[model samples]
Target: MTADTTGVNATTKGADAIDEAIAKGIDFDGTPIPTAKLELYTKVMALEANRQRSGVSNTMRSRIVRIGAKHIPQAELDQLLTDAGFAPLKEKEIAFFYGGK
Candidate 1:
């Protein structure tokens, strides 16, 4: 039997990879992304794009806190924010993001 050379088991992981997959109309798992889901995502993103402006830094901080908390320890994340010239976490953020830990 010939070796399987389709690269079926090879996968790239990360946000860029996911985005590329989405742009190609495929899911990371190699399945087609349903048109309904794509349509809903596009609609919601359109709404977000037109939403009233908050400061760019505020938006950046929100995303960092939201996504960084999942991957970095609380103290490390706080230090990272400070080093990156962003505000360190506030007590409320600490309570919200690291409360369960």
Candidate 2:
């Protein structure tokens, strides 16, 4: 008599071997992870900075700048304007005459 050794058993056996390996100490490949988080953050930050520079929401900019003036320091305000390409002005000029100080 000949035995019909179906491949389903072999498939289950292979799976069992894999499961046993995992139950012990075998490491399986996992989901992909970022290799350089700093680089990823830097790239995203640069894109966001460029988007902000393009006057993405100029009216929103005005509102925020308007409110922030009441809270931020004069030096910090001046630097923010400088980064946005506006020339810095004297203290009184910044507070009274300029669009953003």
Candidate 3:
């Protein structure tokens, strides 16, 4: 029997609609987006858009360190990276990402 594709299409359409609303600064619940929050987000995203990139792998590693450090302990994240065949966190990265924790 052929698989039904309608569910996937519906999900995609719903996501697209939500994205369109977000771009227009309208919340899904129909409230207008707060000006202060929107302005700050736009400014930060603009800066991120202009940031320099070294390479895909370096960028990936940086993102992993930045986000993973928020949710995982330092040693656990480092071991996970090594086990996944990525380079273990460097001293500088550890200091920067986990210094306060």
Task: Give all candidates' CA lDDT scores.
Answer: 0.82, 0.52, 0.76
Q: Compute each candidate's TM-score over C-alphas.
A: 0.71, 0.27, 0.56
**Candidates 1 and 3: which is better by lDDT?**
1
Each prediction's total of clashing residue pairs, residues at least 3 apart in sequence or on different chains, is: 0, 0, 0
Model 3 lowest lDDT segment of ten: 3-12
Model 1's TM-score against the true structure: 0.71
- In candidate 3, how many Å is residue 78 off? 0.8
Superposed on all Cα atoms, model 1 deviates from the true structure by an RMSD in Å of: 4.7
The deviation in Å at residue 67 for candidate 1 is: 2.1
lDDT of 3 at 94: 88
By lDDT, the best candidate is 1
lDDT of 1: 0.82
Ranking by lDDT: 1, 3, 2
lDDT of candidate 2 over 1-101, digit per residue (tens): 43333332344344465444333332233222244654575578679767745454555455446565777776786687678766553566456634463
| Clash number for candidate 1 | 0
- Per-candidate Cα RMSD to the true structure, in Å, reads 4.7, 21.6, 8.8
In model 2, where do residues sit more than 4 Å from their true spots? Answer: 1-57, 84-93, 97-101
